[model samples]
Target: MEQDWTAVGDALRARLDELGMTMTDLATKSGVSLTTVRELVHVLNTRRRQPRTLASLSAALGWPGEHLGSVLRGRPTSEPSGFGSLASVHSELQDLRQRVEALERAVRRTD
Candidate 1:
């Protein structure tokens, strides 16, 4: 069965409305690009699901990371279990990148 993206976008848009949020707010809160949020809103309106779409949506909504996994993948994996929100993931990713860079520099110095 094919999932309709437009409907999904619409439903997601409605959910945002119910929560008193605008696309701009979602973009800011989720740490995603405005364009991505716009596209997801469109897809949700059309009831279609994309790869990692659920993760993005859940993160934006401040809901659990696995919130929409069931709908999109039929089940959620326990892996990457702490997707509290995009802000958290973005923050953590930045920290990780910095640590990796530091490690790389140390390795180069010792080589």
Candidate 2:
């Protein structure tokens, strides 16, 4: 099926609003470059992104890992029952990863 990049962009923008997150925040949290995040949020570039990038953004938004991928594929997104717990765990892991990266950077500066 041909994908709908525009719909993906709109959905991403709305999700960011719902989360009270700026594009930069999404980029940082998702580990995606700010320019790519901006492009997606603004619909400035409709080119498809890597699956990993879409999954990262979706995960950062507290969505199922394949939510954005499904959106891009023009399919209805269905969350499996009890997905909330898994999403929460994913969120916690992302937070821990960011913290570890920060700590590593701090240690590197002191070296």
Q: Local distance difference test, per candidate?
A: 0.62, 0.85
How high is the lDDT of residue 42 in model 2? 79
Candidate 2's TM-score reads 0.71
- Tens digit per residue, CA lDDT, model 1, 1-111: 544455546556876875667788777766767877787677524444454656777666755565555444434334345543454556456657977999999999999
**For model 1, how big is the CA root-mean-square deviation?**
9.4
List residue ranges in candidate 1 displaced over 4 A: 44-53, 73-111
Our model 2 lands, by Cα RMSD against the true structure, at 4.3
Model 2 / residue 51 / CA error / Å:
0.4
Model 2: per-residue lDDT, tens digit, 1-111? 698888889999887776567898889888999999988877788775789999999989889889999998889998788675676666667768988999999999999
Measured by lDDT, the strongest candidate is 2
Going through the candidates in order, what is the number of backbone clashes in each? Answer: 22, 0
Question: Which regions of candidate 2 are displaced past 4 Å?
Answer: 80-111
